[model samples]
Target: MMPAEQAGAAALLRHLAGAEPIETHVSAVFVGPDTAFKLKKAVALGFLDFSTLAARERFLRRELEINQPAAPALYRDVVPVTRAPDGRLALGGEREVVDWVLRMAPVPPEDFLDAVAARGGLDGSVLDAIADAAFALHAALPPVPGLDAPAELGRVLAGNRQAALAAGLPPARVAALAAAAEATLARLAPLLAARAAAGRVRRCHGDLHLGNLCLLEGRVTPFDALEFDEALATIDTGYDLAFLLMDLDHRVGRAAANRVLNRYVARSGDAGLTAALPVWLSMRALIRAHVLSRAKGPGSGLPYLARAEAMLAPPPPRLVAVGGLQGTGKSRLARGLAPGIGAAPGALVLRSDEIRKRQAGCAPEQRLPAAAYTPEASMAVFRELTDLAAEALHGGHAVIADAAFLRPEERAAIEAARGGAPFTGFWLEAPPEVLRARVAARRGDASDADVAVLAAAAARDPGPITWQRVDAATDPLPAVRNALGLNPDDPC
Candidate 1:
C-alpha cells in the first residue's frame, strides 16, 4: 500500500482501539476493508439530534430497528464501546460503557447503481430488480394515521415554496409556482384522502435515489434510509417513489423512469397511484429546487443547486386535446405522449375521467349517477379540466387533456386555453363495433358510456379540427409518435 493508504489503515486501527469511536475519518471510506463501522456526528439539526451520547445511542438503535426489516443480513447490530481496566478502548464486553457505534458488514462500492451506470454496465434487468425490491419494501411499510396525512403533506409543499421565495426567486414566479402546487393538491385532495383511508400512506425511505441502492448478490438492496425524522419518512408511498423518479429525470432517463413506474405499479396493482403520480412528481421537483437554492455560496450547495435547477427548470408548455368517444384509447395515447413532449419531470397530464370522478365522489370505475352527470356537473368538470391544463401549461408543462370532446364548444374551450402555444389535437377514432368492444372489455373505468353513447358521439358533427386520426387497430403510442412528428424509434 502507498503511504496514504497505510496511514488510513493505521487511523482505522486507532479509532477501533478507542473506547468511544471518533466520528471523523480522514481516510477514504470505500478503500477500507469489507467491514466498516459508522459513528454518529455529535451535532443537532432541527429534525435530528445527536448532541448527547444517549440521543446518538437512541438513533443508532432506531436505525438498526428500521433497517433490519429490509436488509436484515447487512445490519449487524448497534454495539456499545467500552474501556478496559488498563485504559484501553475496546468494543462491547468491557466493564464500563463509553459510546456506541452502528456496526455493519459493508458491501463493495462497485455494487452501487450509480457506479454500474457510470461503467455502462446497467441493464433493464437491474432496473427491474430495483423496481421489484422497492415495490416490496413499500408494500411492507405500515400506514400512517389518516388525520395527520393532509397536514404532513401541506407542510412539505409549503416548505418548498417558502424556501424558493426566501432564496430570492422572483415574487411573481414564486407565487405562480406556489399557486400551481396548491391547485394540484386541491384537485387531488379527495383522491389523497381516499388513498390515506385505504392505507396508502406509509413509513418509507424519504430519500430514494440510485446512490442509496445497491445490487447485492443480484438482488437490489436500499440502505441509508431516513433514520432521523419519522415525519419525513412517513408519507404517501407515491411520494417515496417520486424521489427515484425525480432522480431518474435529473439523470435524463425518462424512459427508464417511466418503465420503473409502470413496472412497479403493475407489480403492486396500485392503479390509483397513477392519478397521484403527477402531484408527487411535481412536489419532488419543487423540493429538489428548494434544496438546490439553499446550497448557494462557499461551503454550501452550489454544485447540487445547479443540478437541481436543471432538473426543475420548467418545460415549454403545449396543450394537446384528446378528442374521442369513450374507449377509443384517448387516455392511453395522452399518457404515452406526455413524457415525449415536456421535460421528464415537468409534464402535466390532466385527465377528464379522473377529474369527473373526483368531482363525483367516486372511484374511476364507479358509475356516475344521472344526477352526478347533470349539465352543471359536466360543465364544472370541463371548466376544472381546462383550468388545470392552462395553469400547468403556463407553468412550463406540456398538458394533455383526455376527454371525449365531441362538441365544438368543448374543443373551442381547450383551443382558447392554448393561447397561441403550439398544440396538437388528437382525434382517436375506431369503428363503432370496435369502440363498443373496447368499452365492454374494460373492467374498471370512470366512463359510464356504452355502445349507445359511442353511437351518439359518432353521429354528432365534429367541427373543423386540426387533428390527426389514430387508428385503434395498432398501438396508440406509435400513432402518437407519428402525429407529433417524432421518430417512431425514439425510446421515449
Candidate 2:
C-alpha cells in the first residue's frame, strides 16, 4: 500500500482501539475494549517483508491460517481496512481494499505471562497450563517433510553471532559462544535429522515466550506463531518449547523454568530431547542477546550474553536422592534442591510415585491397585527411575530422585545408578502425628500415601541407613542450602 493508504488504515485502527497504537519493529497493535487490530508495518527487513500491499495481505492470510489450530478462539479474522466513498475509512467497508489488518480477540494487558510474572503471580499451574498448551499444539500436527533444520538452525545461529558482533558486544564471548554452539550442533546433527525424519518437525509457534502467551479465559495459550517464513516456523517440536523454557529461566527464576520443564517432559514423554536442549537454550538466549544488542546497542546485551553463557556452562553433575516415610517431605526437599544443582535450569527430578503410576498406566494422582505395589512392580519402578537418572546424569544433568525408600534394596538401586558421580542422600523425618496431619492435608499430589501407608513404612525396617537427616516440620530450603554448601545468606 502507499503511504497515504497505510497512514489512513492506522488512523482508523487507532480510533477503534481508543488509545495510541502500540508499535513494534514489524507491526502496530491497536487494542480496543474487546478487540485488537494489528497492521504490519510497510518495511523490507530482509528476513521479512511487509513492504508491498500484496505481501501484507499474504502474511495476514497466513497468520489467520496458521494460528487457527493453536489459538482459533482468539484469532478472529483477516479483515481489510478499506477507505470509504467519503473521506472516512472503516474495517471491511465497501470501498476498495486499501490495506489489510489482522483482527483478534484482545487479550487483556495484565493477562500476559510476562505481566503476571512482573506482578509476582506466576505459579505452578501457569507452568502446567503452558506445558499442556504446547503439548496439545504439537500432538495433533504431523511433521512437515524435507525440512532442512540443521542448515536453517545453523544459519539462525550464525545470524545471531553476526548481529552481536555488528552491535559491538564482547567479541571474545561472542566467538566462544558461537564455537560452543557449533560443537553442540555438530554433535546433535544426527538427532536433528532423525527428529525431522521421524516427523517430529511441524508448523510451530516460532515465537514461544512469556510475552507471546496470555491467560485466555484463565488458560495459557500461545499466540502469534511464526507466520512470515515457513522454514522458520517448520521446526522440531521440542525446539519450539526451548524458547519458552529460556524465557522462564531469564525472566522468571531457574526453579520456575525447571518446574515447567519437568511438567512438560512428564506430559509429553519427550525426555529424549534433553540431549539437545542445551544447544537450543543457548541458541535461543544468544538470539535474544543479539536482538537486545541490535535494538538497544552495547550495554543492553550484557545480561542476555551472561544468560546465554550460563545455559552453555554445565555445572558438575550430581545424583541426589530424597527418601523417607510418606509425610517426611521427600518431594519438597527434592524440589528445593533441584534448581540449585547441575546443568541449565537444574536437575531432572524422577519421582518414584510418578514412575510407578506411569508403569501402572495411570495418572500421577490416580491410585493403583494394591497388587500393583508388589515386589516385582516395585523393582520395575526402581529400574525405570535408575534408567532415567542414568540418562540425565550421563547427559551432564543433575538428578533428584523423590521416593519413600523404606527398603534397603530400593536405596541400593539409586546408588548403583550413580556410578562415578558424587552421590548424596537425605532422609526427611517428622513426628508420626505430623506425618498423619500432612497426609490429611494432601490434595492433588502424586504421592498416594495415606495414614495406612505411613504406618506400613514405620513397620518396615530398612536396615542400617547412612544418609543424613533433615527435619521436615518447616521449609526445606535451609537444610538444602547447608547440604549444597551455600552460605545461609546466599541468594538463590
Candidate 3:
C-alpha cells in the first residue's frame, strides 16, 4: 500500500511513467519507456527517516551519488516533483518543490540476477562474472577511516537480536543465536582489528545481494548500494561479501556460492577473510531472518534462522588436494567436491593456475608468457597456496588445493599445510590421448596448459603415487565423493 504522504509524488511518477511502481519499504521505483524514477517514502523508520521533503531529497541525492560510480548507466540526476501555480504536480519545473525523485536508466526485469537465478540461469560463467564484479567494486571502494570492527559488528548483532525478538521469533532460538554470534565476535576481535588496520575495512555496498545486481553493457553490474547510513556501508570486505554469499546459498545453491567465493578470493588474495566468514555468513542470514519475520510473520524466517545457526557450527575444517597431469579434471573434481566438504557454502578452492595469474597481475583467463612459469615462479605459487590453505584451515574452514601436484615436495607441502586438520589426496588418472584431446578443447580457462605442456609433464617422473587414483576418463566425482564419505545428493 502506498503511504498517504507520498500519494502526490506517486501519482506524478505514475503519470510520467504510465506504469505502476515497484515498491519496497523505503522507496518506490517507477520504470518508464526509457528511464526510471526512484522516490523515497515519507515514513520515519527508526533506522532511517525519510519523513520530510528535505530528508527525502537528501537521500535521493545520496543514492544518486553512491550508486553512480558502480552503475553509471543506471543512476542519473535527481529531479524534483514540483507544485506549479496551476496546482499540478509536474516532474521538473521552476516552482514550489514537493518531493524529489532520482532519475535513472530503466533496467529490464529479466536482467536482474535474482530473476536469472529463479530460472536456473546462474551458470559457471555468470557466477565467475558476478565474483569478478564484486571484486572490482571492493577494489574501487576506499578504506574507511577509524572503523572499530568489533564494536560495529557487536552493535549489529545486538540490533539483529532485538529486531528478531520484536518480530515474534522464538525468544530462546534468537537468544541462542545471538550468544553464539557474540562469542564468535569475541574470538575474532584481534583478527578483525588487524584486518581493519591492514585496510580490509572499506565503504562497500552494504546490501550486496542478487536483487541489486543487473546486466549492464553486457556485464554483470552491482547497483542500489546502501546509501542511508555511512556506518552500515563501511564494513569489512568479507562481511560486505557475506550478503551475496548468503543469498546465493539460499536462492541458488551452495555450489554457486562456493564458486563465487573461491573466485573472489582468487582475485582479491584475501584468504584471511575466511577466518571471519562463519560469523559473517551467520549475521547475513540473521538479518534476512529478522527482516522476513517482520514482514511476513515469524514462521517465514525459520529457515533463515536455522541457516544462521547451522553456519555457526559447520563441520571441522579439513584439507583436500586434487592433483593430476594436465587435463585430468583436477579442477573439475575439486569444484565438485568443495561445496560438500565443510561449512555452509563449502571449502575454499586454491587453484595454482589462478594463483599464478594473481602473481603475474593478470586476469585468470589471460594467458601468461612462458617466462612466468619458471621453476622459481612455480615454487612461489605453491608456497602461497600452502600459506593460504593453512590460514583457511586454522580458521576452521575446509581448503581444497587444486593443482598438478606432480612433484614429491609439492605433495608433501600441501599435506603439511593441513595443520592438524584431516587430509585427503585424490590423484586423477586418464589416458595420454584423452588428456591431449581435453587440453586441445580447453578455452578461456585459467590453466595455460596445452598438449605440449602435458607431454613435458609426462616426461618427468613424479615419484611414488600413493594417493587414491580415480579414472578420469569417465565421471570421477562419484568416486571422489564416495571416498570423502559424502552422499552424492548432499546439498551441503
Candidate 4:
C-alpha cells in the first residue's frame, strides 16, 4: 500500500472506532467508545513473520479464533480495511482487502487490572474476581494432547535468553539470568512432565498479564490470547497462570499478588502448583523481561530482571504458624500473611483443615464422620502439615501453617519444621461469644468446626502456649509486621 492509502486506512480505523489509533510494537489498537479495532503492523520479527499482507490476515484470523473463547462477548470478528476506486479507505469493503483488523468490544480503559492498580482499585474483592475468572478459564479449557511441558518450557527459556542477548543486555546479566533459569528448569523437569501427563497442560490465555485483563460486566476477563504462537499458548496450567501472578507482584504490591494466588488455589483445588511456582513464576518474569527488552531495550527491562531474580531465588524460607480457637481468624490471617512473607505468590500454606479433608477423601466443605476427627486422624493431619512445611522450606519457599493448634504439642510439631529458617508463631484469641458467633456464621470453609467444636476447644487445656497471643478482633497484619520487625507502612 502507498503512503496515502495507508494514511487513509488509518483515518478510517480511527473513524470507525471513534477514537485515535494507539500503536504497539506489533500492532495498532484503536479504542472507540464501544468497540476497538486492532491493526497488525507490517513488520516481521524472528518469532513472528507478519510483514506480508497475507501473513497479517492469517494471524488476524488466528487471533480472532483463539481469543473468542477468552472473552467471547468482547471479540466480535475480524474486519478488513479495504480501498475503493475512489482511492478512499473503507471498513469491511467488498474490494480487495488492503489490511486486516481484529474487532472487539471495548472494555473500560480505566478498569484494566494495571489501571485498577494505578487507581488503587485492586482490593481483595477485585483480586477475588480476577482469580475466579482466571481459574474458571483454566478449568474450562481443554487439555493439550501429548504435550511435553518440560521441553516446551525449556524452549521458551532459551528463546527468552536469546532475546535478552539480542536486545543488547549486559552479557553477564543475561548469562546470570540464563543460569538461574537453567537451574530451575533442571529442578522442575520431572515434575513438569508429570503435570503435563496428568493433563494439567492446556490451551490457555497466554498473554495473561494485567494489561490484557479488564473488568467487564463487573468481572475480570482476560483478553488477547496468544495468536502468534500456539505452542506458547498451550502450556502447563500453573505456568500459564504465572504471568498474571508475576505481573501482579511487579506492578501491584506483593499483598495483592499473594491474595490472588491463595484465593485461586483454594477455589480451584490446584494446590499442586504451590511448590512449582518458584520455577514457573521466575520463568514468567524472565520472559516478560526479555519481551520488554525487545520493545524498550535492556535499560527498561532491569526492574523485571530484579523481579525474576527474586522469583528464581528468593530470600531463605521462613515458617509462620497461625493458630487459635476455631473462630479466631487464623486462616484469614494466614492467607493475608502469605503474600508478603517470602517471594512472589508468597508462601506454601499447609492448612491442617485442607490436609485433613484430603486424608478423609472429602471436599473442604464436606462433613466428616466422628472417626475422621479422631485423635489418630488429628495426629496424622499434624504430621502431614509438618512434612509439607518441611518440604516447602527445603524447596526454598516460605511456609504458613494454618490450624487450630489448641494443644502445645500440636504446635510444637509444626515448630520442628523450622530447620534453618526463622519461625513466627501466632495464636489468635477472642471471647467465647465471638468464637461461637463466627463459627455459627461460617460458610464455604474447609473447616467443619462449628459452635460445638469451639466450645469444646475453649474447655480444653491449651498446655502452656509459647506462641504470641494476638487479638483476633483487630487486624492481624500489624501483629505479623511486629513479629517480623517490619515497619507498619511496609506493604510486604
Candidate 5:
C-alpha cells in the first residue's frame, strides 16, 4: 500500500472507533464500543519489520493465530481496510486493499491486570488465576527442540546493554549490569542446556506483563502475544515467567509477585528454575529501564536500573519452617512472611497440603480420600516437601515450609534440609476451641483437616516442641515478622 492508502486506512480506523487510537511504537489500537482494530505501523526495526502491506497482514494473521487459542473470545478475524472507487475507506470492501487490521472484541479497560493492580485489586485469588493462565499457556506450547537457550539469552543481554548505552543511561551502571548478566549466563549455561533438553524451552508469550492480561468470561486471559519475532518468543519458560514476576515486583509488591511465583512453581513442578530467576528478573528490569530511559528520561529509569542490580545480588538464602496443628494459621503466617523472607520476589512457601494434593492428582482445593492420608502417604508428602525445600535453598532462594511438623522425625528432617542456610522454626499454639472453630469455618482451602482430624491430632502428644512457640488465637504475622527481623511496614 502507498502512503496515501496507509493514511486513509488510519483515518478510517479512527473514524470507525470514534476515538483516537492507543498508539505504540509498532502498532496502533483503536477501540470502539464493541469492536477494536489493531494496525501495524509501516516501520522496520532490527528485530521486526512491517514495512509492507503483505508483512503487516502476515503479522496480523500470525497474531490472531497465536493469541486465539488462549483468548478465543478476545481475538477475532484479521480484516483488511479497503478503499472503494469513490476513494472512501471501509473495513472489508471488495475494491482495493489499503492495509490490514486485526479485529478483536473490546474488553473493559478496568478488567486488564494492570488496571486492576493499579487499584490494589490483586488479591490472592486474582494472583493465582494469573499464574494459572501463564502455566496453561506455557504447557500448551511445543518445545523448540533445537534452540540454544544460553545463546538466545546471551543475545538478550548483549542487546539490552547496547540499547541502554544508546538511550544515554548511566554508563557505569549499564556496564556493571551487562558484566554481571554475562557472568551469570556463563554460570547457568549448563543448566540451561539441560533444561532445554528436558523440554523446558518452548515458544511462549514473549511480552507477558499486566497490560497484556484481562478477564475474559470471568477467567484471567492473556492476549497480544509477541507475534512479529519467532526467535524472541521461543525461550525458556522460566525466563518467560520472569517477565511477569519482575513486573509484579515493580508494579505491585513483592508479596504479590512471590505468591504468583509459588503458585506457578507448584503447578508446573519446575522448582529448578529458581536458579536462573535472579538473572532473568534482572534482564527484565534492565529492559524496562532502557525503554523508560528512551521514552521519558534517564532519571525515570534509574530506580529500575538499581533494581536490576539488586536482583543480581540477592541476600543469602534462608529456610524458615512454620509448624502447628491443623488450625494454627501456619499457611496464613507463611503467606504473610514469604514476601519479607529473602530475594526480590521473596521466599518460596512449600506447603505439605498442596504437595499432598499434587501427589494425589487433584487440584489444591480438592479433598483427598481418607486412604490418601495414611501415615506412609503423609510421610511421603513430608519427604517431598523437604526435597523441594532443599532444591530451592540450593538454588539460592529462601523457603518457608508449611506443615504440621507433628512428628519429631519430620521436624528433624526439615531442619536438616537447610544445609548451609540459616534456619528458623515457629510452632504455633491456640486453644482447642479456637482450632476447632477455625477448621469448621474453612472453605475452598488446600487443607483437608476437619474437626475430627483436629481432635485426632490433639489426641497424640507431638513429643517435644523445640521451635519457638507462638500464640495463634489472634494474628501471628507481627510476631513472626519480628522474629525474622522484618519490618512490618515494608515488604522488600
Candidate 6:
C-alpha cells in the first residue's frame, strides 16, 4: 500500500480496534460501540484534497458543520486525534495533536435506502420521505455564487470523451459526444441563469446517492455532504436531485425516478426547476462515467460509458395525444405510455384538465364556474394545450396530452401542431352506459363534468381525427403498445 493507504488503514484499525466497529467498502467505522467516527484518507483528487493534516482537520470540521443540519443525529462533532506520550494514537488525548476526524452516531445499515433497494423493497412512502428530506436540505442550504457550473459539467463530459477516445472510440463517436455536451450547455444557459436568480443554486450534498441516505430511528437522514469546496457542492437544486434520479435510472427504475421527482416538485412547489433536470441528469451521468473511468475495480468504465451514452442519447421529438371523454382512462394510458415512448424519464404529461384549471387561475382540484367553461374559455384552454405540447415536443420531448377532443377544431389544432413529426392519437372509448357509470363512481377528481357532460361530449362531432380507438373495457396496454409500435410483452 502507498503511504496514504497505509495511514488510512492504520487510522481505521486504530478506530475500529478501539471499539466495536462496522466495516464498509471505503471506511472502517467505529461505533462506540455507539458513536461513529470517520477519518479521511490522505489523498488528493482534482476536486478535493486531504493532503495535509491541517487540510484534513479543516474539511473534517466542515463536514460536521455542513451535515449537522441535515443529519443532526449522525454528525455528532469534530474531534482531534492526538498522540500519547508513548507515541500511540488516541482520539482527543492530552499530547500533541496529530490529526482530526468527524465523529457521528452510527446508524444501522438496514436503515440505508440502498439496503432497502437491495432487499427489493422501495415503496412510495419511503420515496416520499426521502424526497421530503432532500427538499428540506436544499431549502436550508446556503447558496454559493460564481461557481463554474457549466465548465465543471463540461470538464466531466470532456473527461469521459477523452476516456472513450483513449479506449479507441471512433472519432465520429467522440465528436458526437462533444457536440451533444456543447449543445446541451448552450441550451441550458438561460435556464441556469433563471434558476440562479431564483436562488436555486446552493451548497448541497454533492454526492446524494441512495447510499448517502438512511432511516435513523424511523426518520430519514442524509449524511456525508461535500465539505472540500463550496463550488463543487453549491449547484443548482436540480443537479442535487439529479444524482439520485440518475442512480434510479441506472437501476432501471424509471418509474420510481418519476415518482420521486413528481413528489419532490409537489412538495417543493418548484415546478419550474424541472427545466434544468435534463441537463443536471446528463451531467450527473457524465460525472459517474468519469469516476468509473478512473476506477481500477471489477466493474470499470465500459458499462458506465454505455449508460452515459444512453443517457445522453437525443430522443426524437414527437407529440402524441391520448384523447377521450372524461373517465375514458386517457390519463391512465398516458402515464403508462410515457416511459416507453423514447423520451427522457418524466417526460411532460400535459393534461387538459390541469391546463384548463391553470388557465382559469385555479387549482387542479378546484371547480371552474359556468363562465369559466364557456366556449371562449374552452378555446383558450385548447390553444394553451396545443402551445404547451408544441413547445415540449420542439424541446426534444415526447409528450402525451390527455384531453377530451370532443370538438373538430380542437382535434385539428393538435394535428396541425404536430409540425411534420409522426403524431399518434389514441382515442379511448367506452360504452355510453359504462362511461356514465364510471364517471358517476369517480371521486376526488378535478373534472366538473359528470355523466350529462360526457353525454354531450359523446354527441359532439369529433371530425377528421386521425386516431386509433382503444376499447376502455379491455386492457389499454395492448392498444397503447400498438399505438407506440412496441411489443406488448416488453417491459418499459
CA-lDDT, candidates in order: 0.68, 0.82, 0.93, 0.80, 0.91, 0.71
Per-candidate TM equals 0.62, 0.91, 0.98, 0.84, 0.96, 0.74
Give every collision pair in model 3.
Answer: none
Alpha-carbon runs more than 4 Å astray in model 5: 1-5, 488-492
Q: Please, what are the lDDT tens digits per residue for candidate 1 over residues 1-492?
A: 213313332344446544223333211222235555766655664546776768878888988888888887777887776667886656678567666667776677788887876776656567667777888899888787755666678788787677766665555755666676677677768777887888989889888888878877667898878888888888888889988876765563676676566446435545456555555776776666655555552224333334433444444567788888887888777657666666544245667766777676554457876687777888998898777666555545566778988778898898888865788888887777888898778765557877777777788787776677777655777757776776655446
Specify the poorest-scoring 10-residue window by lDDT in model 3.
483-492
TM-score, cand. 2 vs. native: 0.91
For residues 1-492, write the lDDT of model 5, one tens digit per residue.
324436778888889999888888888889999999899999887778998889999999999999999999999899988888887889886778878999999888899999999999999999999998999999999888988899989998999999999888999989988998999999999999999999999989999999999998999999999998888889999999999999999999898999999888878778788889999999999999998998898888889999999999988999999999999999999988998888769899999999998889777889989999998999889989999999889989999999999999999999999999999999999999999999999999999989999999999999999999999999999887888888767693
Residue 302's lDDT within candidate 3 is 92
lDDT of model 4 at position 448: 88
In terms of lDDT, which candidate is stronger, 3 or 4? Answer: 3
Residues 334-398 of candidate 2: C-alpha lDDT, one tens digit per residue = 77777777777878788988888767766667777789888898889888888888877776677
Candidate 4 structure quality by residue, lDDT tens digits, 379-443: 99888888878867766778889998888788888899888889989888887888888899998
Q: Which stretches of candidate 4 lie above 4 Å from their native place?
A: 1-5, 85-88, 350-394, 405-425, 433-453, 456-491
List the pairs of residues colliding in candidate 1.
295-301
Ranking by lDDT: 3, 5, 2, 4, 6, 1
Model 6, residue 439: displacement in angstroms? Answer: 7.7
Arranged by TM-score with the best first, the candidates are 3, 5, 2, 4, 6, 1
Off by over 4 Å in 1: 1-31, 161-176, 290-338, 341-480, 485-491
lDDT of 6 by residue, 430-487 (tens): 8888788888997655578888888888887777656888899755876677857866
